[model samples]
Target: MNDTVPPPEVIYVDTHKVACNGGGGALGHPLVYIELGAEGTAECGYCDRKFVHKDHAHEYHDPSPRPEGEH
Candidate 1:
């Protein structure tokens, strides 16, 4: 596993779906992330905002179901 510390990184995923703070609301849910690169640098990273730590974000799935023909 990677041993790293968290930092304040910039994230803009077009929509709040990746919003860490409660769906772009004032709550601020801080997108999930994992350290990449040599250390705590942009060299490499996994942030939920950019499809990183996708599993973590899936902790709570949307209660609503998909459309009749959708999965």
Candidate 2:
């Protein structure tokens, strides 16, 4: 089966947003955001599968700006 996803790359941590997750200091998603650096293998935390390319990982990113036009 073939699924489409963005190619994996070395993403760097650009900023760390510290917000209180609903409770117990948990996070609804990953606690970090990264900037893609170079192409590489991508990993799926859900199934622990290694995707060699972006199309294989089935990952998509929305680079839309925030409502307040924040980056």
Off by over 4 Å in 1: 1-53, 67-71
Taking the tens digit of each residue's C-alpha lDDT, what string does model 1 give over 1-28? 7564433343323222332432445645
Clashes per model (N, Cα, C within 3 A): 4, 6
- Candidate 2, clashing residue pairs? 5-54, 5-55, 5-58, 5-59, 6-54, 7-54
Q: Estimate, for each residue in 12-60, the C-alpha lDDT of model 2 and write its tens digit.
A: 2223322221223443344332223244343434332233334323343
Cα distance off (Å), candidate 2, residue 18: 27
List lDDT for all candidates, in order.
Answer: 0.35, 0.33
The per-residue C-alpha lDDT of model 2 at residue 12 equals: 23
Error of 2 at 35 (Å): 9.8
- Displacement of residue 70 (Cα, Å) in model 2 is 49
| The candidate that achieves the highest TM-score relative to the unseen native structure | 2
